[model samples]
Target: MAEVEDLLEGVTVRLSAAEEIRAKGRRRRARGRAVRVGAGGAALLAAAGAWMLLPPGDRGTRQTVATATANPFRTDGVIQMPRADELPGYARWHWTESAGLPAGAGRRSGPLPQVGLAEACPASFAMTDEPGQERYSLLYTGRDHALAQYRVIAYDDTATARSQVAKVREQMTECGLRAVPPTARESEEGSRAWSGTVQDGRTMRVTVRRWNSWVSVAEVLDGTPAD
Candidate 1:
């Protein structure tokens, strides 16, 4: 009976040792799985941080889309005169908006048919005036022997601008101002020129031009009239 008891005790001790080995193997496998999961989470976090640190211009397609959404394209609708240096002649001339006398003011001398007529004259382009018409003028001076005036007139439509030019042309003939070839750089569709000696004998030249719904009148007086 004592020998049988000894054998059963030995069998019980062997069984307990095998159970301990199995438990150790399970714990090692669970620790390996946990390490792999931690490594994958750290890699994902590194990638996210790198993307956040990139420059705005290097942000690629997202940056371009955001910029286009902020500012939209626009068309210029306002009319502006040329700068003083942009004029054809002397670049050092002084320019002032809405300055100087009107185009033909006080320079007309004559026994012409329209001499005593009202202000509806070609030299001033008064026929181009209307209710919604816009007009801008710049006087240019500072040269030793010359004086200039630049004028711009805007109408509602191109057709009305053409009509205005035609009326001025007809009045110019009736007013005895001979038509000369255009010499001004602003010459366009309805360009017309007239030159004559003013009351004081200074050479006065007037050039009128039409561009779409706009008209430009350029007047130049070269050399002073002798007193």
Candidate 2:
């Protein structure tokens, strides 16, 4: 009888030890899991902060940003204008040989079309005629006598392009023109546009967009209503 009691006590002690070990193991596993979860949360927060600091173009994973190094017209010599096919789609367009920059002239100076702005046009933001600058100009006259004049200017850097865009916007606001939604396609590079009618009963649309190293400006004057 005494031997039987001793064996039973040994079994009870072994069972208690086993239970204690299992409890310790469970506690260790719980701690490890908690640690992993905390690390994951911290990583997620860091990633979100980094994304917020990125530029507008970089925040969108699908878009490409234009850089000055990618500009194709940054040469020191004269850059030819884009071909007709390269220009934006219009009902019809034809190149005017007499309206472009003069031979060997890098830049041109002229009065900006009176678009009913309160402030006078700034000469620096006006069209550039520097050598090695890529520029194109054309007039599209529809059958209805509505005319649209388009000009595209390519800058060497995005800073210059953005500065010019800001100036255009300021001019439009000073002129008391109404702001309208942009109809132009979203650019992977960067873009700004303004459209409104002047007091002269003519509507004007200006779009400044950048692609790679090129900044293009399109000025459309329509006798018809705003589209």
Candidate 3:
């Protein structure tokens, strides 16, 4: 069996390469050159960039934004996570730095963010390039106990977002760490929800939804997770 460290290393390498690509992209945008050149490429870029300009209410479908109470901002690289008052039990949410992940990669504590999920089941669930991605978790203040996590990823198109959601649904079945009964449902037309337990025995309710070209994943534990 592959060790967790090995899997993390692989993810780190890929993320590093992705960061380089994004950096180049930033420079290109700085020069004010067309992001995608030649033959209808401009049209494609327009479509991809349109999501960023959409108003909060116009961003999502009939389904609410996954487990989040608010719509995620479309600004690239800016993570607008739910605030303390926004989350009933959580006093505050904090950013977590994962081992082997590039400083640019978004990560947090709570219910094992996306990087942790990839480490747990590398073959089944792995990280991929995105226009922008971020993770956040509830701050563990030692007194108040709450386990909640959130990840938001932006893609170039809705198709890519849909594909990610499908992969997550599939992971719920393929990964053997599942302890909680895997229940998958479409809370609304364009949203999905799944509940399962990780190896540490945290019963988590994960909700996924896509709006335009963005996808959000929220994980809220049924109770305080094992320490």
Q: Score every model by TM-score.
A: 0.45, 0.49, 0.42
- TM-score, prediction 2: 0.49
Q: Which candidate's lDDT is highest?
A: 1
As for lDDT, the candidate ahead, 1 or 3, is 1
lDDT of 3 at 119: 30
lDDT of 3 by residue, 42-99 (tens): 7777887897677767766424445455444444655666554443234343323223
The order of the candidates by TM-score, greatest first, is 2, 1, 3
**Per-residue CA lDDT of candidate 2, range 122-200, in tens?**
2333454343344555544443334444555665666665665555566666654555656545343345567665654
43-154 in candidate 1: lDDT tens per residue? 9999988998887657865765565442111126655666676554444444333355444443321211112111323354333335356776676654543566666777
Error of 1 at 49 (Å): 74
lDDT-sorted candidate list, best first: 1, 2, 3
CA displacement after TM-score superposition, residue 188 of candidate 3 (Å): 7.3
Candidate maximizing TM-score = 2
lDDT score, candidate 3, position 104: 28
